[model samples]
Target: MNWLNYSEACARNQAVILAELQPLLATTTRVLEIGSGSGQHAVHFAAALPHLRWQPTDLAAHLPDLGANLLRFGSDNIDPPLALDVTQEPWPAGPVDAIYTANTLHIMGWPQAVALLQGAGRLLEPGGLLCIYGPFRYAGRYTSASNAEFDRWLQQRDPCSAIRDVEAIRDQAHACGFALERDISMPANNQLLVWRKAV
Candidate 1:
């Protein structure tokens, strides 16, 4: 058990995220999680949602720790972690009933964010859900002062990384054949945005 790979943020929010996902994913069979990070959410969610096969993925660089964490605490429903860099490639997984990612969009550059949406559109089955959890700007307005400060910190850390606008993401998702279904408020000024693929 490598405590170093643990994420306090993931620990704090996984239960809340699960509460929203449980009912939405009741009928879903396979879930592909992008940017699985330390695998905390994967292990936790897979354990809670035993019926869904959870596939965790991250960039190659993060795979060692991701895989390690999954192996350490993952259940039978959780698949071995795969290497996925949203900006490129075969995605390394079969088609899934749903896609989930947390706090990933703001960490990726704009091009990468676009790629993720496009890829999610390609990978999910019709009527499948694409659930994204993170802070986002709406109509060019920040939701809170803390989120604004967080956005600034992110930009300072990496100019390419900043909070994305919800409208921009919705537009891209629409172009990719997805329809916005829900925008649920979450803790820490973040939101859980749900989109469903057009059937």
Candidate 2:
């Protein structure tokens, strides 16, 4: 039987995410996608935004499924999946017009999340964009009861993983030479945050 990985969340959110990313990335040429789980978003975004050369990456273990998904359904604009652990040094790709990641921060431990932001700072040029899509807490408050439940579930699954605080992330990104440009609300109690590196 043929098998390929899939993410129901990715399937649900790709359209709305694309609506936000389409204009933000219109003038851009390349995009580096961190934690390209199942390669679903990569395929969807690449197919929609053909102007972008999309580089999808994830942990080594996920590469097989990710690569298979990309090979089977990805567009020419989509590159093969690469191994990328946020804590590791020397990311596989170079400077790009923008960096994108979805539903990743809350899955990573705090240190890894910090490292991912730092790595984006290093790889992106001044004025480049870093677009992140995920759930976040504002002023230590969850946007909805469902998000609170999700946080509890996440912590139960992995003690170090829970919805991150927007203020803390903003402060950290600022320290890394990025300024929060936009924080747009999305469906399912999620957010699409855009940051731009100092020019």
Give the alpha carbon lDDT tens digit for every residue of 1-199 in model 2: 2337777888999999999999999999999999998888998999999877999999999888888888788899998788998888899897798999999999999999999999999999899999999999999999999999999999999999989999999989999999999999999999999999999
Candidate 1 least-lDDT 10 residues = 1-10
Clashes of 1: 0
- Runs of candidate 2 with Cα error greater than 4 angstroms are 1-3
Question: Superposing all C-alpha atoms, what RMSD in Å does each candidate have to the true structure?
Answer: 0.8, 1.1
Clashes of each: 0, 0
Instruction: Please list the residue runs of candidate 1 whose C-alpha ends up more than 4 Å from where it truly belongs after superposition.
Output: none
lDDT, candidates in the order shown: 0.93, 0.93
Q: Could you give candidate 1's per-residue lDDT for residues 1-199 as a string of tens digits? A: 4644789999999999999999999999999999999899998899999988999999999998888777778899999988898878768897899999999999999999999999999898999999999999989999999999999999999999999999999999999999999999999899999999999
